[model samples]
Structure formats: structure tokens, C-alpha cells
Target: ASARKKKGDSASSTTPPTPTPPTTVVAAPRLSAAAKGDKTDESDKGSDDDNDDNNDETVKAGSESDKDDDD
Candidate 1:
């Protein structure tokens, strides 16, 4: 047996799912003091540079494997 619909029940009461905004990558502005030839503390600067090493291929190996399986 089917259940009866309640009074004032409208399927349009719920809001529709919104489309995700187009994703974009934003870059940091060039370091002004570095660009201007004003030197900051060298050790701190070197540490920051090391943090940016692009190891995505090594770190994201699982994702690459998934893509390979999808082929």
C-alpha cells in the first residue's frame, strides 16, 4: 500500500543544489624585499624555499596509481 501525501506538501520546498564556483589557483605576490635586493635573514629564507620543493609526484603516488587503474 502507498502512503498518502500530507496537506501543503510541496516538492519545491527544498533549495536546489548550487553549482560549485569555478576553482582557480592563486599565487603569492613576489616577495618585494627579495626582488628589491634587500637581503633578509638567509637561514629563514632558505628554510622557506625548501618547503616549496615540488614532490607532488612522490607524495601523490597513490593518486597516480588510481589514474593508471582507470586507464
Candidate 2:
């Protein structure tokens, strides 16, 4: 009995250990600019209007400067 147990133990110890499965890191899908709430129609229109207003103000200032230069 003792010799049989020793042989079994030696057989198990000689065998290589099973390899673990590789860790798969799956990333989440990337959100589009519209999905992220940046390029939506409402937001884009609002921003475009704000940009147009800012550009008008800048043009007015530029025209004033031009008038000053002309004077």
C-alpha cells in the first residue's frame, strides 16, 4: 500500500500542470460624436447660432476698427 501510494504521488508530481486560459479583455464599443450628445441636430443648431452671433460681434468690431483707420 505504501509503495503504491508513493508511485501514484510520483506520477502526479511528474505530470505538468494544466495551463490557464488567456485573459480576454473585451473593450466597450466607442460612442459616436452624435451618440455622445455633441453632434445632435438641436445642439449643433444652437452652437451654430451662438457662433454666428459671436462672428457678427467680431465683424462689427472689425468694421469699427476699419472706420477708425479710415478717419
Candidate 3:
């Protein structure tokens, strides 16, 4: 009962946070423009961006410590 009270208090007292949706839209305007015409690589660019970001973060961490930070 005491544990539950503590858990409830912790949960309720937490401020509402803005959650970033998992959907990754890479440049909506450019994507729509590409769909109209001009062969534009969307997946490649998005993947590359993700890879770059991951690499940059990994480099900053200086090792495999990123996995731990996520937890």
C-alpha cells in the first residue's frame, strides 16, 4: 500500500510533457514537390539523415555508451 502510494504520487506529480511522434517526415514541402515531378530520393535522404545523426551522437558519446543513456 505504501509503495503504491509512492508510485501514484510520483506519476501524478509529473508534469505533462510533449511527446515527439515516431513518424519522421523529411521535409514535407520537398517530399510533395518530388511526388509531383523531379525524381527525388526520400528514403535515401531520410535514412542518411538518421545514420548521420546516430553517428554524430555515437561519436559524441565516444563509445557504445549511447545504448545505456537511452535506458
TM-score, per-candidate, Cα-based? 0.23, 0.39, 0.29
The order by descending lDDT is 2, 3, 1
lDDT of each: 0.50, 0.71, 0.67
Question: How many steric overlaps are in each model, in order?
Answer: 0, 0, 0
Runs in model 2 lying further than 4 Å from the true structure: 1-41
List residue ranges in candidate 1 displaced over 4 A: 1-40, 54-71
Question: Candidate 3 — worst ten consecutive residues by lDDT sum?
Answer: 15-24
Show pairs that collide, candidate 1.
none
lDDT, candidate 2, 1-71, per-residue tens: 99999999887776533222222211222345435666576777889899999999999999999999999
> How far does residue 4 in candidate 2 sit from its true spot (Å)?
99
**Candidate 2 weakest lDDT stretch, 10 residues:** 19-28
Question: lDDT of candidate 1 vs native?
Answer: 0.50
Choose the strongest candidate by TM-score. Answer: 2
Query: Whose lDDT is higher: candidate 1's or candidate 2's?
Result: 2
